[model samples]
Target: MAAVLLIESAMKFAIAVFSAAHAPSSRRALLFAQAALAGGHEIVRLFFYQDGVYNASDAVVTPQDETDLPKQWRTFITEQNLDGVVCIAAALRRGVLNTEEAGRYQRDAVAVSAPWELSGLGQLHDAVQDADRLICFGGA
Candidate 1:
């Protein structure tokens, strides 16, 4: 009799965060992203929508006694070289902008930069198409 072998395949995932930076949902999403990468899974994109755009904002300041989830997210995205996108409309509404956006809006400063791209819903749609699964955290 021949022995059978079983192998698990790595899955491609698209993560969508819809919670604020200080929210528990965002933290869970970050942890999930880390675990997914450690498990040898691929993260196609990290989409920040609605309140989640705050996580991509450089202006977000963490309390001295609290965890800086935004900074952690930025570091993770930078180190892993992942596609981190924030919804332009949502970001604009929330006052989070990149250099280009800031200039376009005649703003004095840029709230988002490297490792965080300000784009549209199309990016999330594209990521979903390329990923095997779409994991979303925090939404009403």
Candidate 2:
């Protein structure tokens, strides 16, 4: 008699985006993330750093013909229940703020939404450590 063993292939992936929200790199990163989710991979964390922090800004406006990548990302992450983290330091430097951050900085308005949270660099480190694969998308 032969016994069959079933193996689960789902992998935990941590993604980091370092490009501006309007940059091609950012779009590519979103595509990659979509594909990863479609392929049944788990996204442990989606880290927005450097100019990528702009992706979390709620004030972004694009031309009618252009894709609203940040909006798309917001919908996607919200639907998937994925952890979308914007680096606190980077986001602050770029002026992308959530309600708490806006109040802390004494800003009159907040730019980031509820689905995305502002976090420290330690979150990124923990994601890298816990994920089976760490995928970074952006240009230097």
Candidate 3:
């Protein structure tokens, strides 16, 4: 029989990855998130950089019967109480920023959210340094 511990106090996990587009990988990333929670480990932070930043866009409208990426991300973060930060430098170059960034750059009609804050690449280093285990999925 497989032993399943019911509680954990020291596990810290951080997920840093590229955009979870297309099949297989995207599905696996989501499944992995669920598995991490079930194993009594904590998801410390989830950072999406480069193309990965697109995963946090609020205006990603999929076809009918398609997965709503932003909603799924918000639900996971909200339920797990995890920090989800989309790298601001990456987002800015890719054109995904918050209200403050828009004002700073003097632009309009940006597609981002408060749930996913625009931060610098340094945040990733901070998260990785703080987490016990950091898993990176996908590529730039």
Candidate 4:
């Protein structure tokens, strides 16, 4: 029916990330992502640029009760099949890439995840291009 179709259509939405790995911002984003997935809305893509790449790190040894920003994002994206991409330029600039990047650059202890790919500005541009609407949060 038309009503069902309209409801289904309303479920698809996009969200962007440019926030640091802080409790409030990260927790807010996790809640939003969870809501979108529960509502049957497509995340479209989560672009982690600037300080936001920390949200995609694989080894954040925070307390159990503390907000696990990386795990929350990883789990939500994997569970919901969201496209999560981390900007390579920003990741490197801000120290969030993986062992490969660390070895390549002779750095130490990179902390990114394989589920979240390293990307460039073009990827973000493309994501925004395909999304019905682009919504960015925590970008200064």
Candidate achieving the largest TM-score: 1
Query: Candidate 4 residues 9-112, lDDT tens each?
Result: 86445667788777476667778878766665666788877778878887667688877778778887787677888889898987887778889999878787
lDDT of all predictions, in order shown? 0.93, 0.90, 0.77, 0.77
Question: In candidate 4, how many Å is residue 5 off?
Answer: 4.9
Clashing pairs in 2: none
Winner by TM-score between candidate 4 and candidate 1: 1
Candidate number achieving the greatest lDDT relative to the actual structure = 1
Once superposed on the true structure, which residue ranges of model 1 sit more than 4 Å away at CA? 1-7
lDDT rank order = 1, 2, 3, 4
- Give a tens-digit lDDT track for model 2, residues 1-140: 11222126778999999998899999999999999888777899999999999988888998899999989999999999999999999988888989898898899878898799999999999999999999998948
lDDT of 4: 0.77
> Candidate 4 has which clashing residue pairs, if any?
11-41
Better of 1 and 3 by lDDT: 1
Clashes of 1: 0
Q: Candidate 3 on 1-140: residue-level lDDT in tens?
A: 23433553547888886764444455567678778888777887889887787777776777779877667877887777778889888888888778889889999857887677888888899999989988887763
